[model samples]
Target: MRYFIIPALGLISLNTYANVIQYFTGISYANPAELFKIKQTELIIGGTGFHTVGKFEGSVLNFNTGQYGEGSAYTRTTSLLPYGRIAKRFNEKTVFAVDVTQPFHSNLNWDEQAFTRYAATQTYLTDIDISPRLSYSLSKQWYVGAGINLNFLQNNETNWALPINPTASANMVNRTTGFGTGYDLGIYHVFNQSNFLGLVYYSAIRQNTSGTSMLANRINPNLQFNFSLPATTVLSYVHLFNEKWLTNLQVFVSEWDVNQYVRFINTSAPPPLNPDFTFTMRFRKSAAFVAAIRHQYTQKTGLTLIGVIDHGPEKDEFRPLNFPSDTQYFLALAGDYRVNENTTIELLYGYGYEKTFMNNHVQVNGQNLPFTTGKVHLSANVVDLRLKIQA
Candidate 1:
């Protein structure tokens, strides 16, 4: 006979958690299912700091190796994003929760005199999500959950202000803001004492943005645009090998193809010259795989190791300077400590690596311009700290 003691909420899957700076897979927060799993009323606060550094080595106009100066080397930058969640159990079978998280964010800055200024100098994006969720214990072994999301988005970019002339290049800014809505559905099943499966789905949203565009400090009111955030689905499984050892498996699929193009409409008071601007962005469906292991070395301490690989979405078409993404891989180590009966602290360290394929072609005004380019190398480290208090 085999006997496995299952503690109150022992060996929960950790795959539901995501890397703080993952390649563009739309904006999604850590699965809320994990928050309600143990039926503990708790408040969790966490923050992630991602230190990213990269360089662009190739020529902007497909010329000689030294055609452009060393300005292509960018300076390192770090971004901090925070998240908070609170879950309360109204009854043994019902749970309510609220979450505030930064779903998607990025800031790419280049050297002030980078030759790529004509193409791109800087781009910043921010997305905030507010969610409310409800979970029901359908039965002893089954559970269901649902939630709604309100997302606010912002886009800001800076580049050479040249419209038709390349010699008269100046600094310019383009900015916009919008909002959207989405929903989430989740299911969890405990087949036996040692096995568990969880699934979640998040819907897509469309944002229509309008803002002013500045050229050398001059404002232009013809900077309205629109884009779509893709939907996502995740599946996770957990297996307990013994009372002290456990493993988790996770698979993610995101529909990122909807972000193919961004169309700018001129809404100026008086008709401006060429009030319509359209640009193409190459994006495709993507998937990722994750595996993790956890060991409860003692009653008060736990250690976890995680590895992830993402098959990023990209196309042969011209890649933009703002959003540079490719296949990504990561390794992470984490530790959890229980300070007391009502408090827990978790700390994580992760490293991410990516190499983007060279864009052998460029696009302008829906026209394809051929050029041989060099590869881009990107790397970042993410440090996360979280405090959870059970009330």
Candidate 2:
């Protein structure tokens, strides 16, 4: 029931969506289940995304006044990712396809002189995914899908304002790239000509990363570490009310609990020079719900409406904040026009808002730890343009 202007990223590589406060959980034009009825070879190319501005207000302990103060973080950013898909039918029962997308993304930055500066002054996370897959008809009403993954992940965090002493400050940073392989499996079943169901799963991938860690603003030690990307499952359903109306619903489940901390260490460095840096990012299991309704008003053009609700993983008590996130709602509109028998073009525009509640603590030498709770305002809009061609 909650509706607002939150940006829906380009949905193929995305709404195929957002990461960080979210991980690709939004209404999309491309779902793997879209191949269910394609009898011929097809290609889809598109671009999606927009810009965001935010204001951060939080509780902070003031040393001189011995009272809590508010507002320390601010950010403005723009994000746009790519998407493409190619599906070719080998037989009546088998279809081969390749999808190129950026599955997950997160970019949240904090100013250098903020009260919440120690945890991270900068944070970014995203990945590129290429999957080649096959969907085969098991029967007149059932289809099965399998695929292989080539994934590349990138992560960066810069920790600043370490309270080494009253006279000085320190900085720490860890930036790395992870590459690995995984698998995708899915099943699709249809009850009739107008209705069907789909389920797909993506396995967790291991990132063996090599990068440098900046410790205490001095030593830059080369380090290595291994981290895991969370596995995900999606269930989708579609039904046509009549010749002119249709609806699609999807439930996305993510195993975000599998991720904890990425610890980096230098094997060859001396004890004094050994810098063991750990990036803490912990989460609980989460899910998102989405729906889309399409109405064809003319022979050459159609319109669709989309809605989504995503529950974030961070909850209860004090946890080091990795990204500001909470329950979010989104609404989007898309219109499509057929250029010819072989081509179709679609455009989507959307917007949304996020009100965040956070409980966080900072490391200090004092006996009493001050935990802060506050709100984050994320303002952004979404726009996407796509073209699909068939033979």
Find the candidate with the highest TM-score and give its number: 1
Whole-model lDDT per candidate: 0.66, 0.64
The all-Cα superposition gives candidate 1 an RMSD in Å to the true structure of: 12.0
Give the alpha carbon lDDT tens digit for every residue of 209-276 in model 2: 77766545444556666667678888889999999999999887878777655555552222332245
Give the RMSD in angstroms, all C-alphas superposed, for model 2: 7.6
Instruction: Extract clashing residue pairs from model 2.
Output: 5-351, 5-352, 6-351, 6-352, 11-14, 11-15, 11-16, 14-17, 17-24, 18-24
Each candidate's TM vs. the true structure?
0.86, 0.84
lDDT of 1 by residue, 77-189 (tens): 78777888888998888889988887667677766456665455666777788999888888879888888999888664433323323233445566778899999998888
The ten-residue window of minimal lDDT in model 1 covers 6-15
**lDDT top scorer:** 1
